[model samples]
Target: MLYSPFLVTLTLLTLLTASARAQQSGPVVATPQRPPVTEQDRTEAQKFVAEHHPELASLLSQLQKSRPAEFERALRELVPQTQAIQRSKERSPARYESQLAAWKIDSQIRVLMARWSRKQDPETETKVRELIAHRQQLRREQTQAEKQRLTEQLQKIDEQLQNLDQPETQRIQAEWEQLSRRATIAAKQATKQKTNTTGEKKTTAKKSSDQQPAAAQPSPGSR
Candidate 1:
């Protein structure tokens, strides 16, 4: 993760907005979210592998038969390719940019809702209520200029929220989802490799164990 504040805010708001929509139906559907991997990322990653590491594409079957060293070497080579894909872009696709803006505004609505849910300080409650009401009024404005002004206001709010030491819970949750997904995938891959290796070792050990008894028995007549 590159800690570009602007990209962080943009990505956080994007996921937050999606989560809010899901929440409206009932409970929020909590899926592990990864950082926005655009089509460009996939394309470039495939291209890199095909161009630089064509053999890796077929490593799965080969790894089963090859030495563990070969598998480790392949994984080592993939790390830089993965990093290049991840660092390729700091922003989402252009088609998603407008959606991000809309989601940014929706996330503020969620912020207000979360504050209200806490029901803690009366002062904070009143302030949040006022912000919600103001946002609703902005939504009702008929003029294009008024809408643009509202968008600007929302953008400023997003920037301010991004700067806070403790980010809004929604943003934190969204980031966690991204990190969790990445971790989960890596963990699953490691577990799978371990299982396969363990299975292979067990099979080899069993064969050796079975052969030992037969060898010790010698010829039938010797027994």
Candidate 2:
């Protein structure tokens, strides 16, 4: 229930990826395929965590010992750190361009993988597949304008998919919403518990200090 910023970001990214995959229309392929997470990708992630968030390496254990309030505080502290790290990485021109290219290809492959996984309803699935095939075809066009047109078309498709109301789409949306709500609620409860615990500890210490002074006072006769 103690969700760190890194965990939260990773979860959001995964959900967004799934949502992106679901919006496409595609025929079910025999084999599900996705772009492999290359060694370079792994290395980059590890390096980033090691250099920027060494505390994250022990985050799980820390969370276990932390009160809900402390956990929430930690998450709040981590958000800006995580953002700063991402911004720093993105500022590197060479790395930014390379990551951008890799992301686009990975996104396309993930869409295909989602289709193969049957994430879409049959009707929606077919439509997404058609759109994907069309995009692929457009990629072969040898002009910058043509490539730009392809981008426009893809964006239009994405917009349409977002607007499309269907039982399956609603179901997926509801599930994600529920997950987000649960995480929020858990964090709130943890914060409240931690606050109460801290208050009690303070009161107990005060009482103990007051009793100690009284006990140390000499009896009236001895004084």
Highest TM-score, which number?
2
Query: Candidate 1 on 82-194: residue-level lDDT in tens?
Result: 55434433443432433333333444444444444444677767775775676555445424655787899999999877666565897788888999999999999999999
lDDT of 1 at 206: 93
- Score candidate 2 by lDDT: 0.52
RMSD, every candidate, angstroms? 26.4, 24.3
Q: Candidate 2 residues 1-223, lDDT tens each?
A: 3454445333323333353345458975574563444545444544544453343434423543544444444343334333444664667754444433333333444433444453447765666566567555544542454577689999999987875655787868988899999999999999999999999999999999887844466779986
Q: What TM-scores do the predictions have?
A: 0.22, 0.23
TM-score of 1: 0.22
Poorly placed runs, candidate 1 (over 4 Å): 1-167, 210-223
